[model samples]
Target: MRRLGSALLAVGMLVGCGPGTQAETPPESAPSAEQQQQAPILTTTNVDVAIECSGILEFANTASYTLLDRYLPSNVVTNIVNRRATAPFTSLADLSSVPLVGPTRLKQLEGGARTMDFIDADCVGILDGIAISRDDQTAIVNLVNTIDDSELHDVLPDAWNGAVNLLNTRPFTTAQQIADTAGIGDVSFRNIRNSATLSRPLEALFTAINAIPSNGSYGATTLRHFDWWNIASANHYYRDQKECFGLEPTSVPYGASIRPNLANAAEVRAEVQRAFDYVGGNTKVSAAVRDAGFANLDALIQGRSFKGCILTYENDPWSRNTVHIYVDTVNGFSVMTETWWAE
Candidate 1:
């Protein structure tokens, strides 16, 4: 809610003053006689100054994606794109007749389209905590609340009322009111309030920040840490683990295993062979073949047994990546580390 100031004055001139209108006229002696003698007397007319309130001003971030998904279903969107590529619609009616589209839906879609074409089209200005149109200088602030009902009743509908409420009733102004109505105290209300008073667009900036990963090594992981390559790598490991050993992380207890103890070297070698074969045979191993190799290099030094082995690959090098494959005497197979390089 940035604030701007405006002044409106309606200037008019009083014509002839009759007997009954004498009281309304300024005293002749108050100013110059010449001024009073003027046929049209100057008078100030008070006009109610209204400020236009727009929903666009209220949006902490644009709702372009939301509007797109709502109005343009997948099929409709695909059809529209295809139509645009092949041939343009001759009329609005032809465009509206697309499948999964009705009059109401079409109107919403058109509004969104217009908003996209002219960035400021959807913006409505608010004056005195209410939405007002500049053309008629009429306040539609209260009408904003009825937007939902209007949609159902086939009237002029506003989809931005929720956005308006979010702006006007932001936590800064309405926190105390909300707490009071909800039978809570000011301290509690203040604790949960998310109203930001930053002069810039903090919310949109934060959204961008949240999308990137905090890890410096990886380019950028998602909030879910399911980056494209990570997902592909995980799927590869998951498929091999399931098919070769008939085992899954969820099915096996942490301290238990399919086999009671480590089998003989020959049996371990067979399992290692199976793992290598599985990885090698899979043509869709995302990285280079050299990057996908796995090996078991366990050996005994002195009397101590070296049970775990490192699976190294050229692309996923020791400097940047490490994959630790362990064979527990008690728990059989365990993947200790599967990490990627910083590049």
Candidate 2:
């Protein structure tokens, strides 16, 4: 099982981050002692993410739908929305009194106050990697994958320990199952069910790239030396093939060490040089890789990914906004920035 079983409330959790994007920033405060105890201990369900029931407006992505159906079902989501037709929900409790939401669901609602695991209803990306759509709704933006436990601490410090502890002990299949068995507040479950997926928000993105019918026209990038999109596509197939089976996702480790045969060498070279810009100074990136024991650019990226070669800066230096890197690892040349699942 994945170490972050708790990180994914759904699917193999988040996958395949885009290049050039930054990692989630670390927080100013550690989670309060209280929050550390209540966070949801979750696992990927490889389930389809339900649509957004933003409560602010009828979702537009689906021409015929208007609410999320992953948690319970469409009829139920519709009922809750219909009841609150006049206003947006301020909290999950708005539905606590609804018929289907009995004491158990209510408990989930109450828990929202202490801990949350889903994307905010206001968030703009697809949720939990399910790819389900809410009618008329666009996907959320800047959504971070919550599947990485180390990253989770900054965003939800309160639940970080719970997520970690749970991940260490068990592997779960559904958010509802985790909530019921793990006692994650019912509301937290609702948050995950209601929120956008944390999985790599790039399926549509990569698909669009592959569909470009690139017999050669679509794969080029300005960076000049490499095929960024091609690498991303290769990375996708390597990771998604397993996710297609619904098994726990095995993370693609940073390469055993940078070596000449690495697939994403071009992009890795570009980013390693770029790392010097943010961190500052002519020798920053050089020093970074050199300190790690490599000197020249080719040697620096020989068997590794940008993950090890670049210095992690305060502003989510982990993100590669324009390029994705693949390393020679278990997932077999998978990128580390985002999450992906076989839909």
Candidate 3:
């Protein structure tokens, strides 16, 4: 993903007495003893960026104003300074402490830290090894759908060139789709998959505390049952990628951009029990759980799987107490938290 190349051209002006083009420095200005003794410890063609978790933490805690200003927006740098004043950042997840720092900004910060070194030793960060985040999915989908000849060659190595021209057809759904289209051999298939994965966008993950309903009863229920990662992803955040406890929510700038916080899922059995309790405890909830062959909340939690339910409250104005459950494979167990608030 990182490539380095540079070119230097020098032209020497000859003096009146010189037949060959050779420029010599005047003896007096040639070198000073002190200046000659000074040696640079590092040399680099480009800035060294830190992509690892610890490296990012170091940058957040120690980066100077000049360095921060070079990469982050002025307002964001101010927010970072203000937050750091309260406490030094503890983890990559603590990035949520700085407002306007999300997927995009995180990428900039990761590759922004500079050092006088030719190679970056801290570029070991990856989004996720086993599971792909939403950002990863979007980037991969885009790349496969729109790779040009040069881009295709650049992404895949020489061994994969055989399968390169075969990808001219548009819109590939998965690695398997490309393999099928090209009728590539096993090696080509493996190469394509590896390239696709390596080509996914690399960004630092911050623990994004998902917004819950203002009603405390509903909020507690949502957290206790549903997977936090699932909820954060539903809110369009990349979380649960790291192990960090007690993360704080970022402060949104007043009169700035504000997006709606919405989460929805299907076949939520145990996840909906507590919410159902707050809504006068629906019988369908129990029936769904029972029908799923789970005796109680403990059983459902221990060995939870997909289960559906449809609840409609006619008397209530908000949501009209309507909860519709369809078959969703995105997450096995999830709860829908829909909150409506005014400015």
Candidate 4:
């Protein structure tokens, strides 16, 4: 059950989240009536899930360089992997294209933990979202758990103060629900993207921690599915109060330094506007159709990037000739493509 002043319960100031969505930019998570009506079955475990998902690069493509360097056939690493730097392997499937990630090696990767759950989907351009299975709890928790309590003071004040209260509440299907509720800001999300983690099998990790529950606590239960906010939020993140997506100060340079390709966020936003404006002006598109496109863009741009960021792509099937945008502030960078024709 939720605490007395939990953000969700006390988000009395309702404000529109944009043009399309039902949730407002207040301290309330966006659970539908059905979700709210259903009583939550909370599970508490003294055991913590040891692993999240693979780190940024792994989600984008493969496991860490060290893992690949050690695991892949020595011949393959020398002939195919080492040269990838100059060529830049975009996806794990590209390994096949690179020539040495042959059938035997691919099979090895499939059975192994190092390269197992990489999200390598086809992308025509900038990816809009990253698809992660709920079973891949590691990645979901990794990104969400990165935002620290200290930062939340300004970034998500409501969440920081009411962390315990919020956890006493129900499940969240999407991080956006919590972010939208707390009215999270851009600075917080960006600061958060800089700190993330990963790499360990879910089953083994659970088995290890769950071997014994602590202090008469119930065993921990995690979500079956948790999508990256295409944005970020702490409320949607903390499955339990003790975990912060490992948000404490860290010294891991690789995860700490990763970021998206956009050189400037403002420039990217301007380009997004110009693309939509051009689509809205298309004579071939009916006035109603054109207006409809703008409306979709309005909701997407406003709400889509609220938690994370919106990625733009060229020749997207979503529009006739306009750009297709992907809103992902979830995994920091380089997971994989989750393409959608959603206008």
| lDDT of candidates 1 onward, in order | 0.28, 0.30, 0.36, 0.30
Query: What is candidate 4's lDDT per residue for 120-150, written digit by digit as tens?
Result: 2111111112212233333323445543332
lDDT digits (tens) for residues 28-106 of candidate 3: 2333342232211111111122122234544554455445666778788677756665566654456654788765666
- How far in Å is the alpha carbon of 72 misplaced in model 4? 2.2
Clash count, candidate 3 = 1
Ranking under lDDT, best-scoring first? Answer: 3, 4, 2, 1
Model 4 TM-score, 2 decimals: 0.20
User: For each predicted model, how many residue pairs clash, with residues at least 3 apart or on different chains?
Assistant: 8, 55, 1, 24
Off by over 4 Å in 4: 1-66, 102-104, 110-132, 135-343
- Give Cα distance to truth, residue 202, candidate 2, Å: 3.3
- Candidate 2 residue-wise lDDT, 79-128, digit = tens: 55454443433323344455575444433322331122222322222222
Positional deviation of 39 in candidate 1, in angstroms? Answer: 36
Root-mean-square deviation per candidate = 28.0, 21.3, 22.0, 28.7
Candidate 3 clashing pairs? 267-307
State the lDDT of candidate 1 residue by residue for 146-233, as single tens digits: 2232121111112133333333553432222333332223222221121111101222222233343435553211110111112213
lDDT of 4: 0.30
Candidate 2's C-alpha runs over 4 A off are: 1-92, 96-148, 152-155, 181-183, 186-201, 206-343
Alpha-carbon TM-score of each model against the true structure: 0.17, 0.26, 0.26, 0.20
